[model samples]
Target: ISVWTTLAALLGGMLAADVVLGVTPAYFFAALPRAVAISNLWLALGKSMVFGLSIALIGCHYGLRVKPNTESLGQGTTASVVTAITVVLLVDAVFAVVFKNVGL
Candidate 1:
C-alpha cells in the first residue's frame, strides 16, 4: 500500500514538475529514467518497506505504553504520532547518508 501510494504521488509530482517548469511531458518522462536511475527507485522502495515497518512499530510501542487515564491516552497518542514522524525523518536522513554512494 505504501509503495503504491508513493508511486501515485511520484507520478503526480512528476506531472506537476513538468507543468511548473513548462517542460513537455514527453521530455520529462524521457529524462526521468536518467534522472532517477532504476537502482534509485529500487533503493527507495526497499527503504519504504523498512521505514513503514519501523514507523508502525514505533507507534505501537508508544501506544502500548499508555496509561489508563484519558490524559495519558491522549498524550500517548500524540507522542506516538510525533515520534513516528521523527523516526521516519531520521530514517530518511540515514538512508540519504548511507545510500549516497549507492546513487540513491
Candidate 2:
C-alpha cells in the first residue's frame, strides 16, 4: 500500500509540478543531493511500515478491550484512533531525529 501510494505521489507530484509549477521531473529529482534519492525512498518506506504496525497494534489492543456493549465499542474505537495518531506522530518524530544525519 505504501509502495503504491508513494509511486502515485511521485507521478502525481511530478506531473503537477510540470504543469502547474513549471518544474520538470528531472529537476525535481535533481533537487536532492546526488545519490540520496534511493535512501530517501527507503526511509519513507520504513517509516510507513512502522506506522502501519503501530496502528495495527493499537487497533487490536483497543478492539480486544471492548465489551459487548455499543458504548464500549464506540469508546474503544475513539481510543484506538487517538492512540494510533499519537503513536504515529511519535514514530515520525523518532524517525526524523534518528535520520537527522542520514542521506545528508
Candidate 3:
C-alpha cells in the first residue's frame, strides 16, 4: 500500500506540475534535489498520517450518516481520493514554503 501510494503521488504531482506550473517531467526531476533539501521527512510523514486520519474520520462519519448504498460507497471513495491528493499537495506546498522562507 505504501509503495502504491507513493507511486500514485509521484504521478499526480508530475501531472499537476506539468499542467499547472508548465514544468516538464525533466524539469521536475532536475528540481528534485531542491525539494529533497527542503523537505523535513519526519514532519512530512507525520503530516501525511494526520491527513490520512482526517480522511478516514470524514469517510467514517459520512458512511454512518448516509444510507448504505452504491452512491454512498462511491462518494466515500471519491472523498478518499480527494483527501489523498489534497494531502500530497499540502505537504509539498508546506515543504516549498518552508524551504523558501528558511533559504534551504
Candidate 4:
C-alpha cells in the first residue's frame, strides 16, 4: 500500500508537470489542443491509479498467505517486493507502447 501510494503520488506529480509544460501557449498552439492535453493528463492519472491498485492488491494477497515463521515471512516479503517491481515495470512498458502508438 505504501508503495502504491508513493507511486501514485509520483505519477500525479509527473502528470502535473506534463500539464504545465503542455499548456504553454507556444506548445499548446503548436501541437495538440488544450482539451487533448487535459485528456492526456486524466488518462495518465487513471492509468497510474489502476497500476498502483493492481500492485497493491497483489502484494496484499501474497502477504496475507505468509506463515508466521521467520523464513516464510522473509520469503513472502521478497516475493511481494519482486512482484510489485515487476508489475510496475510491466505497466510502464505497456504505457510506453500505448503512448508511442497514440503519438503522445
TM-score of each: 0.72, 0.84, 0.40, 0.59
The superposed Cα distance between candidate 1 and the true structure at residue 31, in angstroms, equals 2.6
- For candidate 4, the TM-score is 0.59
Best by TM-score: 2
- The number of residue pairs in model 4 that clash at the backbone is 0
Which candidate gets the maximum lDDT versus the true structure?
2
Judged by whole-model lDDT over C-alpha atoms, candidate 1 comes out at 0.84
- Candidate 3 TM-score to native: 0.40
Clashing pairs in 2: none
Candidate 1 regions with alpha-carbon error over 4 angstroms: 13-22
Worst 10 residues of 3 by lDDT: 37-46
Model 1 pairs in collision = none
Model 3 regions lying over 4 Å from their true place: 1-39, 99-103
In candidate 4, list every pair of residues with a backbone clash. Answer: none
**lDDT (tens digit, per residue) of candidate 3 on 1-104:** 44466668877998999999999999887886678653444455556676667667766765676657888788877776687678667866876676554424
Residue-level lDDT of model 1, residues 1-104, one tens digit each, is 76787688778977898779887768877887777778877887899899889988988898889989999999999998899889899989998888897753
Better of 2 and 3 by lDDT: 2
lDDT of 2: 0.88
Candidate 4 residue-wise lDDT, 1-104, digit = tens = 54566567655655665687544544434454533555555567777788879888988988899998999999998998898889889988888777764524
Clashes of each: 0, 0, 0, 0
